[model samples]
Target: MTTVIFVHGTGIRQREYNDTFEIIEQKIHAQRPDIKVAPCLWGALGAKFNENRASVPLEDGTLALSQGEEDADIVLWGQLYRDPLYELRLLSLKPIKSRNPFGEKPGDILQSRVASLTPTLELEANLQEAGIAEIFAQARDTVIRSQPYKGALLTVSESDLSEYYAAIARAIAAQAMFISELQEKFPPILTDAQLRDKVVELLTLALTEAKLGLGGWLLKPVLGLAQHGGTNYIRRNRVELTDKISPMPGDILLYQTRGEKIRQFIQEQIAQAEPPVVLLAHSLGGIACVDLLVQQQLSGVELLVTVGSQAPFLYEINALYSLEYGQLLPEHFPEWLNIYDLRDFLSYVGNKIFPERVQDVLVDSRQPFPRSHGAYWTNAKTWEAIISRLP
Candidate 1:
């Protein structure tokens, strides 16, 4: 029997994780019952956050619960909310020998102070209540106004301001405990204006040191918000699931912590299965699969299919574990086919990046942004591509 291993992407909750893959498995089974399907479920180990219900207006002029079984909350909130925070923290923590007049690098000094502060749950809520977004916007405007180009010509779309919002949110959340203490310590003297100025200063410094260009700043927040939202949904519905999946911390960090579990699972599956195995990986799963083939040097995969994955982009940023800088593609790499939808912002082309034995195919899922990312599982073209390539 042909062992078909399925790998899922980010922000999947315990309640619906199996169903997400089962949907694809059922499709594949209906076409080829002879195939054996197994899923590598790692989303159960993702970070948990609280979910709050909000009514979203539909096109039909009715309201609906934003959280759905197949909703994009995992990708939207986990990656978006936590990724930027992780990046900023990493950037600020980088060791620098250069010292300013204060005998410390500006970035290091500021981050050290921010890190020293302890955040409480109550403080986090208070900061959120204080309108952190407005404080960030005002600071950003001031910074733009002081630039060479007048503020009139500096234009940033709402979409572009996503990362800034996320970064601001994270910074606030991280430092909330300290801010609350400060408020309590100086309730009579500390004013809202002073607090706002402090937040702007902290965020501006963090952004500048991170070297996130205007575009990066914008994109990070948008992605972070999605990740934050998705994680919250998972946390909210965590108790409702029959199968209990433990919560893990960090979006990208989860890869480091739980990647071995997935890798071992795939390895065990391949070892027991017959030769010419067909491995189908989606989203972060694709990244893990590539790392196994290229880095771990695992073999026996006949055909490797990656759908709607961020592998190419992640590699460019040097994020892939096995595929490091200046490394050549493995000689024993399996024949690879990458499928992506144009509207899926997270999906990217891998042929150019790994041209040795890779074929990049683009499909029109015709679904909206985040929906397009998950649509590949059910798309006729995706199934056709997988079936045609199976030996």
Candidate 2:
């Protein structure tokens, strides 16, 4: 039996992941009665997936899951919160090298210092209370204003709040590494000063990498509703477009950079599965699935389908030759059809996708949508089209 793996996206909560998987499964099963489907939960929150001594100690001391929990294979899919790791790296005792010679606002400087350490719920609340939120708003405004004055712009610029969150993630991973090193070299009962030194060292490493200096490469530009003007911009407009089928857990941002971690977990899962699997990913999850397929590592995936997906992950592959370099090429889709809705902001339009090598179907989504992001399976026509295309 083929296993369908569901990888979730950012701002997704545990219960929402479960419910979406259930809805998708029921629809898929009704069409292809024999398939076995499952949802994989990865670390959407920073602390939840800490590979540190603290988590182990806490689990051993207080609460722990019972045995036999491994009945089904576990895969950490979607985005992982990496802000904690970045934060750890930023918090090293060594004074962080300031790229901005003018120096950041006092609150910005202080919040960055604290955010680079562990994420305590109270610490976050305190940062907001202490005017860091205002500092960030001012920073955002400064960046916008400095658009014309290129030279005066801060050398270490983080374009989005997501980047700051990512910094927090870097801290967590760095902390875990620091603990691992401590365990390896030092004996039990380390002095407070020793711990302080370690924290400084880690933070230094994180700050160095996070520096957005001239000629530094940019990863994926944070894609979402734009801040203003465009129909796709969701941030500036406080419009709630969620479509609900039931009373399920709402979405949440667990930690920064959770996307990358989730993607890695899914890649590992696909690689290790005993039986061939089918990856059905929606929106950003679809991008993660395409990433796995293009790696040429998953020999077991019979088919891969992306619905209402962002194009870059699949379009850049070498398999689909019809696409042009830097011009949005469509290539090497894994033995299945890719579906898009016209009004869905996640999916793109235009360019000739090879009908023979890789199938592409576009659906009109201007009609009432169930949700702003995930209406692919909920719509009857979309489900029918998907069922027809399955192998």
Candidate 3:
């Protein structure tokens, strides 16, 4: 069968990710029925990879690849092991073939000799040859930097992984129930800082419980993104900045059940699909797509529509981070809508009406109910505006 593998990326729960994909599928199938659509969930907190590998290395030298599914062609994408395997395969190649080559041709001997010698040295070398060792080593660290996080790392006793998997299952199940509720509610009005805090908390909790041992490495960037997102959300909403700013948005919005992770999963699904996949990410999700496109991590996101989004602000926020580190913004942002609610604090924020910043459409949503930062996507007006953008 011809297959479209939807690879969900980082930070999202699976069920909500699939819901967004289902929304896109509905739009596409209405026009064309021959295509098959599927969401290949990569699970959260790198869980899918971990689960695939099964036995992770513990404080003890022993490790196992946990679940017993030994099929080599697991995902069928071929992207998973191709590059690494190809590099390894190159190591086994023989550059020079010698039968009685003690005194063969000099020219062939000189060039072939060096090529043969190179692989010999390369094979015996450390994992730096593959270049993934550092990341793996960091993943193996035993101690965490903070004491408060000790309980988190330790929570993932061997028996706890099954529970962690179950918890993720529960998180995704709860999100599935909550999604439709989101469609009807007004967007919440938490500042970017507030949103970031929530994301950080959820991520910390998730990582801690899972025993990923990646807290220190993941914390700053995660917090930074959340805060940056929160700040950008406020600036985009045009909430009047106090002389002394109040709380920043937390990392996780808590309402939509981790929008960034869901957004990443959707785009990843799009990237893995056959041509003609439609994608609709509300608010920060659109921001995520723009970032994905900019990073060249995904492509071919046909019929992309973002409801109540803040794509431009992401550029600015990324620019702010890049400036702080003396780096350059990589590429131009993509084309998408910036749906806004006039009454919503996030809607009044910076460059809200400007079209030059990647097809900005200042959508005015008349929220039928009281809402905050997370409610903007659920507003009926927002959906109506988005329907116009869908193919």
Candidate 4:
């Protein structure tokens, strides 16, 4: 029976690690009951942040987000960017404060625009892109069915049809983009942020064709959706930013500088494992495993599975501890299985750089980068690939 050793990624606390690791344990149990799973968890030995430490205040005094703030911001953007329907959903849920029954209702205009949109979208959404058509139908159905839509339909009496039509257009566009569905059918041609912008542009044309005459100006609110989300998120998680997320750089720094102890610990785990071992590592843990396996071959290790790891990138830059820029992987290195998600910016493919030595497998987490990075273990395909290679 093969011994599947599990290694965790960076910035992971004990509880989070335990929950993710448990999923692996259970998945392996269901698939190959004879196999044994081991832990090479190195987070405790890696870097940590102090929650009590207050963040350094900016000159204006708003706490600067952790060094990882930009990355965190990208994650927030990813949330809004990936889900085209998010903006409309938020608008549909808002309380209707004022309505003019004499005036056109936003829902009425939305329904009309959707009706106009159907034939044009049918060409693409219904045929070339059936998923988009489904999303379009669902989005329209959801809004029209909402109590707010019903209330707005009844109560709207204002002549200022501007806001009503504007909101309607945005909601329709946001719901119609349904980016995740598009990505599954086609290779992601644009980043999440880029995709959101492109969809908005397309939405304006679609609405114009449908005769709503809703231009980019009316759909402007969609552009700020991510910013609005980030502002609210920061306000809610101020403590988490200063205390936990900010210290993530510490772990990266620690692994790069004080790495011997981390690598040694992994070696020890390998030594103790039964024969036919697999070094299953994630993120920084994958880096350490690559570093250790490069320095000297441990007898039992037969496979090196890395999920969302930066090892290949590090080696290309000559930053990996054990291997230099010009050197090929040591002859003793185990067969490598590197798994990555296209949405995960931190995850790299090794096949391009390492050729036949590495196998790069892609899994769709249906999530943006931040969530995608951590979501590997939960993706069924990640295990399917790993299990297929298990001895």
Candidate 5:
């Protein structure tokens, strides 16, 4: 009946993200296994640079890092999740290099077959059961007539022709799956991407039988067009720079400019959760949770638990995105629970500023400043405070 969304703060990379999440999850479930703990891992979307902070300079007015040759799928999926037509649009940007002046233009082959694609397999039952049997046909056409689809076909060749149809199948299926996946009754064996890829494989085989290369696998054609990109560096650095010195502060800097992606991800988690959801946010994650809930009311959210968060600080300085200095917490804002430690400079009390709207609880980890900031997870008193307040 209740879900706790563990919203982690800045600098917690992927590996640490998993480990830290497990720590809290196991601890919570140990006491109350009935409660579900969801992970809100938004660090990767935070600020990062492949050029290695090229924008930041030292005491002297010189660049910090040198240039690199090349570096990214989470990046693609991030865009894809937001816009189902994203990959189709990206494919359209590619110049068509096909010069096949042979029998049956590859474009025609694509349009003809693409319109009628259906799953002959058992998955068909799930589609029919979900009352979405026409999902494939609709998805296929949606991809075909799209501006990107037309553009991709304009100068295309036999080799890459299959790729376009497959992409259409993928885009359409992605949207359908995105909606259907939320239905607990119709569980999918394959993920949305996986299902699309499987269907694309079948289509690829059929197209190949028709005496066209279709570029072998759809993955190659999709990835071949894109070289190294900046987001790829975000992943690369997370892997390569695993040391403590690595800065994840870019999250704070980037969130101001590109906060929607992070907020949307949180919202998606909220959507998946049952009602009476509690957001257990830390640091910048707390800021994001505040910003999102402030702008619009999320149905299930009941309380926001901010551990050493800067949401109040940001609001005090008039820097909080959703609420300015003179503004008050929205009338519909969810209940707030702010946790702070005097030892941790990053932690701030919300009671003084927001009054009854938020309650600030102090639990000292005895560790000084920066160490105290991260010690909240390890301290018993912190968990005691958190557990006592959970709905």
Candidate 6:
């Protein structure tokens, strides 16, 4: 029997993580019953370090005298910044506003506009004469709220505010230009009243498109702001960021590498298993596994499977443990298989970076961004790849 040890990613609640593991185990067992799957359960150990308590009604419909709650069980404190107030503040950054209007670059926006434009340059010129330039500038300026006083509440610095507004302006300009081209294609047969209505409809559509484009750019910075604030909040509450239920991915990586609990658990599990170990790790878990293999010079790992991992990027940034700035892959490093979807921004190709004994497979996961990252377990291609590689 092949012993498959599963390691999960960061930011997962304990119960949710366990449920996911169970689902994956069931799928794997259906194909290969001889394979015995076991969860590393490092997340539970991580959660234990930051336990809390809350009153809860029992099965008898009475509150327990002493209640026990794992830090991981509390979702609110873990995701406080998800609140509307914080989100609105984060979205107030100028760069965020600009990027939020349009997701593509000016060139892409222009190309798309030109592609969709009517062949008549005269109509296009007339549309350009429709006062769109002024509207575009106004729309862009409004994307980011301009009150410097509001920044005090959001904790945005003056310089950042300026930069944010400038980005929003640029995005608005690009979007306006794109929309102006479409405005020219308005039906020439319309009467004065009809033309007024048509122009309103076109301008409204253009503004919406501009916002959509800018929204994509705004997302990253907004997320960064939330993460920074969230970390500070966790620290201020006398909670070690790592011990918090929903620690940042970077913090989770640090704990997995330097902390004793998770490493010890994996060591214990490996020592007792009789069959060759097939290690399956996802996202941050993959990074932790690589750290363990390198730092401990661990042996007996027959195969390593990583899905939706940032290992390649992390390695390039000198984040992985036991791997030095310029060191090559160790001779004892186990054969590895990496699975990733192109839509998952966190996932990257590993074989190009680590050529020896490593194979990277790109699987099409039709899910949207973020969802694509977590879709690997349920994806048929992912399972088939793992099962075929089993020794």
The number of the candidate with the highest lDDT is 5
Report the C-alpha displacement of residue 247, candidate 4, in angstroms: 4.5
Assess candidate 6 and give its lDDT.
0.58
**How high a TM-score does candidate 5 get?**
0.52
TM-score (C-alpha, index-matched) for candidate 4: 0.56
Ranked candidates, highest TM-score first: 4, 6, 5, 1, 2, 3
Which of the two, 3 or 6, has more TM-score?
6
Worst 10 residues of 4 by lDDT: 209-218
Greater-TM-score candidate between 4 and 6: 4
RMSD after Cα superposition, model 1: 17.7
How many angstroms is residue 228 displaced in model 3 relative to the true structure, after the best TM-score fit? Answer: 34
Clashes of each: 18, 42, 48, 8, 0, 14
Worst 10 residues of 1 by lDDT: 147-156
lDDT of 3 by residue, 268-350 (tens): 57656676554455444444554555555343554445544554454455432112222333444334445555555543233
What do the candidate models score in CA lDDT, each in turn? 0.58, 0.46, 0.37, 0.68, 0.71, 0.58
Off by over 4 Å in 2: 43-260, 272-274, 313-333, 349-356, 365-372
User: Cα deviation of 252 in candidate 6 (Å)?
Assistant: 2.4
Q: For candidate 1, what is the TM-score?
A: 0.50
- Return the lDDT, model 1, position 170: 44
**What overall lDDT, based on C-alpha atoms, would model 1 receive against the true structure?**
0.58
Runs with alpha carbons beyond 4 Å of true place in candidate 4:
49-239
155-209 per-residue lDDT for model 2 (tens digits): 2343332334333332332333344344563322123333423333343334344
- Candidate 6: deviation at residue 110, Å? 25
Candidate 5: regions farther than 4 A off: 52-246
Q: What lDDT tens digits, residue by residue, belong to model 1 across residues 124-238?
A: 3443545443233333333233221121112322233333433443434333323444445333112464454344344444433343222343345444554455544445454
- Candidate 4 per-residue lDDT over residues 14-102, each given as its tens digit: 88878887899999888899999987778788765354344533323355444333433344335444653443444444455576558
Candidate 6: how large is its RMSD?
A: 17.8
Show model 1 residue runs off by greater than 4 Å. Answer: 44-249
**lDDT pick, better of 2 and 5:** 5
